[model samples]
Target: MISCVFLATCFVAIVADAHEAHEPVVVVDSDAMRQAVLAWRSTLGPELTRQASFEFAGPVRTDWHFVPKDRLGVNWHDMNLEQRRAAHNLLRIALSSQGYFKALAIMSLDEDLRRLEASRPNAQNVRDPERYWFALFGDPSSDEPWGWRIEGHHLSLNFSSVTGQVVSVTPAFFGTNPAELRDGPRAGLRVLGTEEDLARDLITSCTPAQLKTAMIAETAPGDVIALPGVEINFGEPEGLSAEEMTDAQQALLRNLLDEIIGNFNAELRERALDELEDAGFDKLHFAWAGSVEVGKGHYFRIHGPTLVIEYDNTQNNANHAHLVWHSPDNNFGADYLQRHYAESPHHQSAK
Candidate 1:
């Protein structure tokens, strides 16, 4: 048998390797991410820094959308290599390893689109992975509140912090053109494969009576934004609640939720989970619409007191897909800001 000391050393080495394998799983407080953001901005000085910064209450922070449209911020494409790396460093801290890899993989698809330009209609140069923009809402170091976003075609991540702790990471959006690159230089690739499969599994697991209430529509819209105005309720919770779901159905629902919101960094992921748990899973609703088969139009949504996760695969013959997670109550740290404003009535978040 191995010596006790050697066995202990082996166990420690295994733990170290596991830690190395999953780096971002370590809890990083908002102050660390804030310092990274400020240090990165300092390199640009006033002009460019001011250009990239925006007011917390400005339209840019609230005028959210996932479609390819004119956005206001400093585009990554315009930044130097070092500046781009600094921006990516902030993202590295802000997103989990799973999320960050998913993001970079989505960016690679831009190259795939470029290669398939003759046949792909979305070959516009706007899809350049580097074209993503970053804009900070205020000074994160100070006591006041602030927010930030790393956004571009098919990817948008919004993060808001109160007093250096992330309070809201809502409106996280991820999408793709050819959900599966069946044939190409980069064939057999599916970034969001699990997200889709889990929901489908939950839907298929439902009983006929459960599905009757769950299937709200025969044809899902080609896309859904889940923005502020979007109706979270398709119609009086048109599906079974967690309380009524079978044991297996409930487990699938929980796992489906875990897969979706758990894409963020550890700290923010816990915050999202806390919000969901506080809302009570029994209060959550799982609904489905459109055809149930692959390569057919389909959509599903998980809506709760403050959380909404929407997925629509209705474009490109059900190849194009959009997924967004929204927390209406805490969006942009609105609830936190409201509390802060009430306590200090005269204090404004942005000077």
Candidate 2:
């Protein structure tokens, strides 16, 4: 036990030193988030804890998808009202208020879809937001590595931390069907509205020569291109570079980026912007696909080194929309995993 503790201490020391040498790019609201999740765990017994967890190295950690399906871990329906409220607390802390509100709005769409699709055979139970599941991978720890996920239809948020420092939050995704409600209390609601409108303004402003390089396809894909848990090989990015944008167009681009990434808390937004700056805005490629008309099938992708944002509105007759952020270098705890593996060369993740 003493030897194990010694080794762990030494490994942590190395990570700490590395961290101190650089600015904390990935800042987590750790105290609040930890307290929330830990509070939720305190309400569960050992069996419940075990049932709600998987190894950090397990397949379950990578089993993220945007579709609505039953997933492991304690779900909203499995919890009583109190537990449900606690889950919302976790979401509130982890997400920006804008993000939290967007999530709530997206969840609300499920009821509309359920009512609209009840006639479909055996599909009535498909869109319950209460079915969202939360699972902690590995034990909850402030001095060791751990991760968690809260996922359901139209939403998937995965976060990774080491010794309470958040290192990654991706492939984060948020999507909505019936992207706009034509008539209802929710009429004119567009959960991912800014992502679409801004991209269109930029794409439409593409000059004839610029459009040639930016228009990758005649039709948009039905969903975001990069799949979960995989590196996206988008090939050499093709589009008008940020260096070519007019001042007004550049402002539009900046707004689009903010809308896309500002869904996270301030720290995350800053870290992402820092990375974007490092890559240089001139390196970003804005590519468009499909019809230019509003309320029609369309897609746009902002691709750059270490960053990718995809928005697609090609389903539900272009009324459904999907938006996602990807970090090819940092999904599923990749950054932490690299640091951890460096110090524990002989250590293997618990299977």
RMSD of each: 7.6, 10.6
* lDDT of each residue in 211-321, candidate 2, tens digit only: 898899999987888977566788877777888878888889999998878778777777778989988988888889999999899989988887888899999899999
RMSD of 1: 7.6
lDDT of 1 by residue, 1-351 (tens): 222223223443554676788744588775778888887787676777888888887777876766665577787656776776677678778887667667766666766666667565665764555566788887776777788887777888888887668888877889887798889645766778888898888888888888888888888976874654575444455566888898998999988888877778788778777877897979898888898887788999888887878899898889888898877667778888888888887666464
lDDT of 1 at 214: 86
Regions of model 1 farther than 4 Å from truth: 1-24, 119-124, 225-235, 349-351
C-alpha lDDT of residue 122 in model 2: 62
Candidate number of the best lDDT? 2
**lDDT of every predicted structure (CA atoms):** 0.76, 0.78
Whole-model alpha-carbon lDDT for candidate 2: 0.78
lDDT of 1: 0.76
Model 2 TM: 0.87
